[model samples]
Target: MGFILLALGLVLIAEGLVYALAPSLVEHLLEMLRALSEAQRRNAGLAALALGLILVWLAFRFGV
Candidate 1:
């Protein structure tokens, strides 16, 4: 439970920084995502998920 909260807080901090530092860039990114087809979006999401899982695995493996 604590780890979940930590991960959520870190994600929020990163997201907040992006919006705070470059609101326009975030809008542009969203627009590009909107332009993608549904299949493309799903693939992109899956890729991100895989990458995140790999990263988490690495962290655990290395005792980080």
Candidate 2:
């Protein structure tokens, strides 16, 4: 759907900006993530997924 495509594009733009503005920070973050255990990574990913869903839900709910 259009909304899904728009969301994907926005995510790409945000990710691009982070890499563009702070390449070293991004590399450091990646290194830290690589050092995390599988379970820790999975939990972190789940937390991010839940947070993103909540944000999107609120955005649509509030017509923001």
How many clashes in each candidate? 0, 0
Those runs of model 2 whose alpha carbons end farther than 4 Å from true positions after fitting are none
What is the per-residue lDDT of model 1 for residues 2-64, given as tens digits with 9 covering 90 to 100? 879988999999999999999999999999999999999999999999999999899989996
Cα lDDT tens digits, model 2, 1-64, are: 9998999999999999999999999999999999999999999999999999999999999996
TM-score of every candidate relative to the true structure = 0.96, 0.95
Full-model lDDT, candidate 2: 0.98
Q: Which ten residues in a row have the lowest lDDT in candidate 2?
A: 55-64
TM-score of 2: 0.95
Screening candidate 1 with a backbone cut-off below 3 angstroms (N, C-alpha, C), the clashing residue pairs are none
Residue 54's C-alpha lDDT in candidate 1?
99
